[model samples]
Structures are given as structure tokens and as C-alpha cells.
Target: MLQNPIGISRLVLASSSPRRRELVASLDLSLPVSVLSPDVDESVLPAWTPDETVRQLSAAKAQAALELLKGRSGAEGDELLALDAVIIAADTVVALDGEVLGKPLDEKDAAAMLMKLQGKRHEVYTGIAVLQSGNGQMHVESKKTIVTMKPFTEEKARKYAATGEPLDKAGAYGIQGLGATLVEEIEGCYFNVVGLPLSLLADMLEPYGIQAI
Candidate 1:
């Protein structure tokens, strides 16, 4: 359709996360984009497993964006989502023993998470959902990665926590930034740990429209 590298005419990102926005923009898309802040409940139910939590959260985001765009689809020059239904959303969770570790609530929490993860291996799970708007159908995929952190003492944890990098990231760490220093190894899709799981996203979106070069 468009000359953009992504061949997309319109892409609406249903997230306010800068990381997700940057990941999508890196695709060199030629379409206009709108970020809809998904203000929904992200609380996990006690019985829901880690995989279920991520899937539900991502689906919730995509559905919310689709509903938000419905009002704008009919107006003149107000095409919000692409006519092809290109909506992308994702959720990532760091899990250990089936306990999902989301963004830390505060520095204390962040430090505790880091301490628990020191010289330990854990799993990072990211759930991605892409929808085609025409028939109200979408495809979804999930990726799980194993990441091991190097041993770090309490002093290091507190110091790292002070940087504020871990405050907004799952597992109280970021694999793409300074937090990488904390990781000794990873055994899966690198992007999954970063939050988007790009390969899985591409696969899920392909049936509807997206593919990697």
C-alpha cells in the first residue's frame, strides 16, 4: 500500500510506554500513529498463571484501542486505525516459580527483586496481540525467555535501584540498558526480555499483514 518500509498506512499503538513506541517506530513505518493510553486494570488474579496474565493484559490493550478508534473511523480525515486493522499491543512479565514480577512498586521493592534475582535464572514472558479491524479478528503470540543475572550484593542492588532504571521495567530490570550489566546470560528471544517480542509479533501479525525483511 504505502511506500513505508512497513507498508502500513496507519498504525495505532495502544500504549503509552516509550519503549513500545520506539520499537514500533524503529520499523521505519510511513504511516501516522496515535498512542492511546490504556487505562485498564492490570491486576493479576490469584489463580491465573504467568502466561495467562500476560495474554489477558495484551488483549485488553488491543481491545481498548479498537473500541477507542471506532468513533473516529467514520469521520472525514479522521482515520485513526489503519483500514487494514493494524493494531499492535503487548505485555511482558518476569516470572520465578510461577510468581509474576511486574514493575516494582518502589525502590524497596526494586531492591528486593534484584536481591532475589542475584546470580539466579528466571523466565521472561511477553504476550503480543495484533488485530485486523475489518472483521474484528486478531492474532496473538507469546514468547518465553530464560535470563540469568550475575551475582550482586545488597550495596550494588541499592545503588542500581537509585538510578531509577528498574522502576518501570518488568523483573525490576531492563535487558536493553544499564541493566544488561546485571544479566549474565539469556536463552531466548532477546526482544522478549525487552518487552515486545518482535519475532513473535511479526509472526502473529503476518496472517493479517506484517512480516520481517
Candidate 2:
């Protein structure tokens, strides 16, 4: 078989986020994709900005998955390592007034987060890390989108939260699903707000001789 230069035999997503998985699939790339859940601490570091926090978290996940792949294949030879699959990892967060808002714990928490986001503009930051396996050549980037939510009452927030969709999403909302009705306007990459930025992914993959189109 002809060897691909980057040595990536397949694509792996080092995330358990169903949204991310769905987004990547939407790219319609005709390559083998596998999902690996990386066990990395996601606690934000003290004094790190929202962008930095997500970037660090994404990189951590990617590197952890890469190391695990290396260990699994035991492909210590540089050439052998280069020929492994590429791992893509990402982390997303919603930030308002410099405070990061992660997934809500329960209905109450989701309602509270939605209430805070209502009638306000918030930043959605998604950090992505893509790496070639074996040699571990990697690319990391963060994309931000400004989302303005329509003014709504706490009662509305509670009603939406009760549906249980917001409970598992950062900032108590998922822009791509039922939560779309809550968004008033978005100022950046829509896909970034959805979780994985397709344009960014294309750019990141291009240098490695991969194409999403």
C-alpha cells in the first residue's frame, strides 16, 4: 500500500461530546473515525483567561489521547509513530463578564445559568487540538463567538431548562438544537458555537494533507 506522508491511517476524536462527534461527521470527510474519551482534569487554572483555559484543556485532551495511542501501538520508531491516526480534541466554554460557565449540574442550575444569560451577550469559546499520531505533530487553536440571547423571563428559562436539553451543555444551552430559539444574534463562527469549528478544522487539517471537502 502507498504510504501517506503524514502517516495518519485514520482520524480519532478524543472527546466524548456527542455534539462534537456529530459536527465532525457533518464535515463529510471520507476517512475512518474513532472516538476516544480522554481522562483529563478540566478544572480551570487560576488566573487563566477563558481562551487560555479552553486552549489548555483541549491540548491536554489531545496530548493524553496521543500518548495513549503511542502506548497502545508501542510504535516507538518515529516512522511507525508517524503512520498512526490523527487525534482531534476540543473543549468549549461559555463566558460572561469574564466568568466561565460550564455544564449545569441540574435543572435548577440550568435555569440559573439561562437566567443569567438572558438579555445579555456572552462569548462562546471553543478550543481545538489536532495532532498526527506516532510523531505527534499537532495544531491547536481557539475560536470565539459572541452570542446575544433574546430577553426572556426567568419563567421562560425555567421552562426551557425543564426540558433537560440545557443540563448537559455549557452555558446551559445548546445552540444547534432546541436552544436556537434563545439566541438573538451571533457575531462569529456559527459552527464554533455549535462546538467544532469546521473552517478551523479544515485549515488545521490542510497542512497535514487532509481534506474535509
Candidate 3:
């Protein structure tokens, strides 16, 4: 095992998103990462804005994961309890004209969302929460990236949606995958559109004694 200079014994990711898992692993922190997918209500109030929606959801995921860890018993649980673990949770959304667009309900819904996004500029907001198990200290922040989509025909949008890549992605597109063809340009962090913003996350982890650099 590699020595962790950050003083963190474990890292927990409170999400099942493969993209998130991959991003965290790319940091090469050397600490073992435990994944505990939190089950929580994702519905937001009609009045909540995109940023607020993601922020609250991310915090809820962290809290839910913490509760799960607290509920476990026996050797594994006891070992976790003794370690200084950091739980990382995140939520993402696409906002167009201040309207929040989440994962599509179906192929039709994906195609529709893609059609609406084409030839338009939208904002991708990713809310990240870092929680420390040692002291229960938690910090939450949101990052936004502006993406402009290339103008495409409805037929093209439907074809892309048919690929099924957009079904599980916010705004019905994955900028890092086949959906990259649909994007014209991005003005902010590209990783934010993929899901987690690495630079922002690195800064957030700094206070907890974990440094990516």
C-alpha cells in the first residue's frame, strides 16, 4: 500500500455514478475508496434554482451515507468508525434559461431535451459536498460551466438519443462521450459537464488535509 501523506485513512464516495468514480480514481490519492450509494429524495421544490437544487441534493447524499455508516455494526463497521474517512458526494444538473433539466425519462424525453439544447447556450452546475467522518465537518459548493451546443437537425438529435448514451446523462448529453459531437464550445471547466469538477474538488479537499498536487 502507498503511504498517504494527507493523513486521511479512507475516502468514501456517496454516489454510484461511474463517471464520478473514475474521476476520483484519477486523482490517485492511494487511499481505498468505499462506495456507498445513498438513497434519498431527489425531487426539488418548484421554487428552487438549479444551484440550490444540486447543493441540497449533494449534502443530502453525504448525510445519508453518513447515516448508513453509523448504522453498520461488527468488525467492518468498527474499523470504519476508527478511521478518518472523508465522504464525497455530488449532484449535477443542466440549466437552460434558468430551467433545470435532469436525466431524461426515456428516449423521447432525451431527444426532446437535445432538441431544446441545440444551437443554444446552457449552464452545467455540479454541486459537491465533502464530509469528514472524524469531526462531522461538511463543506458544500457548486460550480457552473457554460456550454454551447451546435445547431443540429431534429433527426440528428433523435439519432443520437437512439444511441442510449444520453438516457442516463443530464440534459440528455454526455460531453465526454458521443455527445461531444453536439457541443460547439465550453467556456468553463469541461469536467464539470462530465460530472465532477476536479480543480474545484481538489480545492475543497485541501481543507481536509488532502491535496491533489
- The prediction achieving the highest lDDT against the true structure is 3
State residue 16's C-alpha deviation in candidate 1, in Å. Answer: 1.4
* lDDT for each residue of candidate 2 in 1-213, tens digit (9 for 90 to 100): 212355456788998889889888988888778788878988877799999988999999999998777665665554443356788999999999999999999999999999999999999999999877756667789999999999999899999999999988899998888899999999999999988999998888777668877
lDDT of 2: 0.86
TM-score of 1: 0.89
What C-alpha lDDT, on a 0 to 100 scale, does residue 184 get in candidate 3? 98
Supply every candidate's count of residue pairs whose N, Cα or C atoms clash at under 3 angstroms.
1, 2, 0
Q: After superposition, which runs of candidate 2 have C-alpha atoms over 4 Å from their true positions? A: 1-5, 74-82
> After superposition, which runs of candidate 3 have C-alpha atoms over 4 Å from their true positions?
1-7, 73-77, 81-83
State the lDDT of candidate 3 residue by residue for 61-167, as single tens digits. 99998887766624365855524789999999999999999999999999999999999999999999988865677889999999999999999999999999999
Clashing pairs in 3: none
In candidate 2, clashing pairs total 2
The residue ranges of model 1 lying beyond 4 angstroms of the native Cα positions read 1-8, 72-83
What is candidate 1's lDDT per residue for 1-213, written digit by digit as tens?
222223446667888889988887876655667777767789889998888888989988888888777766765555535365578888999998788999999989999999989998999999887766545566667889999999989999988999999999998998898899999999989988988877676566555445555
